[model samples]
Target: MTEVFFYHLQKQSLEAVLPGLLEKAIERGWRVVVEAGSRERLEALDAHLWTYREDSFLPHGTAGDAQAALQPILLTTAPDNPYGAAVRFLVDGAPFASAEGYERLVVIFDGNDRDALAAARDAWKRAKAAGHDSTYWQQSERGRWERKA
Candidate 1:
């Protein structure tokens, strides 16, 4: 079963935290797929990942990129996994219908958004009911991620 994790973004914006998480996944030698709700959001993220910080950037490509199969991190709006990713990230209210072939499924939602919170809760419930091991994580005041449930 795929392990599901909910990351409740409160103290930090997704831009502030996502690169680090992607780095960690890459460190683990995991291929990743990040799915967004819109093409504009996906395009923005594709650009951001290349220059998320002045010092370093996560190597990634969108589905339309050449040799997408070789990208360690892929960003796409498509419902299916294209890069044979081991981990999948659903952000910006992207719908997660299942986690069939992935090792991990991470759902990141902004705590300040009521709709995002509702959707995360629903995803949690569905994940639990499907027998997927699920955990909830929230950012601490100092901006470190802490597992809350």
Candidate 2:
């Protein structure tokens, strides 16, 4: 069964925390796929991943890229995983039909957005009912991620 993780963003924006999570996934030798709700969001994330910090670089590409399979991280609006990534990240309330093939599924939503929070809760319920091992993580006051439930 796939392990599902729900990250509720409160103290920081997605831009502030996503890169670090991607870096950790890379450190674990896991290829990743980040899916956004729209093309604009996917493009924004693609650009952000490249210039998020001055000293670091995350090698990534979009589904339209020719060598997408070579990228450790691939960004897309659709659910296709061209890189055969072990981990899949759904951002901006993007919905994933199933967790099949991926070792882990991560859902990141803004806590400040009532709609996003409601969607996350629904996803959590669905994942639990499907027998997936799930966990909820929230950002603390100091901008640290803490497991909540």
Candidate 3:
């Protein structure tokens, strides 16, 4: 069964939080695919990942980039996993179908967005029904993630 993690964003924007998560994933030596809600979002994240910090870099590329397979992290708006990632991140309310091949699936949704929250709930139900191990995480007042469910 796939391990599914749901992150509810309330205090910070995805841009503020995603880089840290991606960095951790890279530290774990996990190939990753980050799926956004749109091409614009995907592209924006692609750029952010490059310049998020002055001293750090999260090596990644989009589907159109050359030698995409060599990238440690791949960004896309679709469900395609060209890099054969062990982890998939569904950001900005991106759709979730199945976690068939991935070792883990991370769903990051904006807590302020009713639609995103609803979608997360539905995804949770579906993942549970599919016998996946699921966890729900929410940001605390101190800006740390707390496992809520």
Candidate 4:
């Protein structure tokens, strides 16, 4: 079964939390696909991932970029996996109907948005119904992710 993790973002924005997770995935030698909710959002994230920090780098690209398939981290709005990534991050309430052939799936949602929260809950229910191994993580007051029952 595919392992699924739901990250409820309350304190920090997705821009803050995503890089760290992507870095970890890279460290594990897992190619990644970050599925955004829209093209504009994907473009914003593509730019942000490149220049999120002055010192560090998280190499990524979109389908429009040349040699996109070779990117270690590919960002897209489509449901298709272009880079053959084993790990996928679903942001902005991007739809995920199945977890087939994925090693892991990460769903990040804004805790403040009612629609996003509803979407997250729906995703959780689908994951559970599909019998995927799922876990939930919520940020603490100190701004650290902690697993919740």
Candidate 5:
């Protein structure tokens, strides 16, 4: 069974929640791969992980073609692209070829707007609908981190 883990980061920076998630993934002996549009952003969280490759750019267009060739199972980020932000890759299945290689899917959002929440909800629904077990971890209005319960 594919276990879906969702983590909602309510704080202003990814710092608040990313470390904990990376730690848990590491504890489980999972290899971590992070992709983001900004090098500075990925660096803020990369310090905690043991092994990570940084791509200051995102997966799109011709660049996206190269990323697909690489075939990374675990994609992590505070996505800046609208498509990435919407978690569209999970649905498209093109840029992200297969789900079989990944053990889990984790998305951490800043939760600044209702649309982001809606996107997260929709992504989870689609993943579940496709029978690819998924979950979301996000921050509540009160400013504490929690998973979808």
Candidate 6:
């Protein structure tokens, strides 16, 4: 069975680990969907990897066509694994809801950001209500990303 490990890491840790992770994923032929706040980080990984800015929206002038522009990128482009495998590395309280669409969701919380932690808790509630087996990890200033599980 294939397993997806969700890593909740700090920006610094992400920067250090991403290149190697991407390379390993490619080498293993594993599908990866990286959700992050920084466009630079995503672009740095590889041009072939699809990058999605969860907060980005189409221009107001194209409000009606916004869904058309965003939906394909958000939903269709990332291929699915029949073996139910995938990982999510969330940063700054992002990527915390309805993980049902994916096999597993790993939430990364920065210990320094109280506000982001609160937001992540709220999102955790929503995910639980939606029936996803989710978990969270805290990244310390010492650069360790620790999780309960």
Per-residue lDDT of candidate 6, residues 1-149 (tens digit): 11224455564545455545455544554444445545553344333333323443211111133443332122121233232335444543345545655544545455346886676667667766675665555456685656654
RMSD of every prediction: 0.9, 0.9, 0.7, 0.8, 8.8, 9.3
Model 5 stretches with alpha carbons more than 4 Å out:
37-40, 47-98, 138-147
Going through the candidates in order, what is the number of backbone clashes in each?
A: 0, 0, 0, 0, 5, 1
Candidate 1 global CA lDDT score: 0.92
lDDT of 5 by residue, 1-149 (tens): 45555455456455544545555555565554544435454444334232333532222222243453342223434332322221222211112222344566555554665754566666567667668877665566776766665
- Candidate 6: the clashing residue pairs are 8-108
The Cα local distance difference test for each model comes to: 0.92, 0.91, 0.93, 0.92, 0.45, 0.45
User: If scored against the real structure, what TM-score would every candidate get?
Assistant: 0.96, 0.97, 0.98, 0.97, 0.54, 0.49
Cα lDDT tens digits for candidate 4, 82-106: 7689998999879977888899999
Number of the top lDDT candidate:
3
Worst 10 residues of 2 by lDDT: 93-102
Alpha-carbon error at 112 in model 6, in Å?
1.2
Candidate 4 residue 33 C-alpha distance from true site, Å: 0.3
Which parts of model 3 are misplaced by more than 4 Å?
Answer: none
Model 1 stretches astray by more than 4 angstroms:
none
TM-score ranking, high to low? 3, 4, 2, 1, 5, 6
Worst 10 residues of 5 by lDDT: 85-94
Model 3 residue 10 lDDT score:
96
Which has the better lDDT: candidate 2, or candidate 6?
2
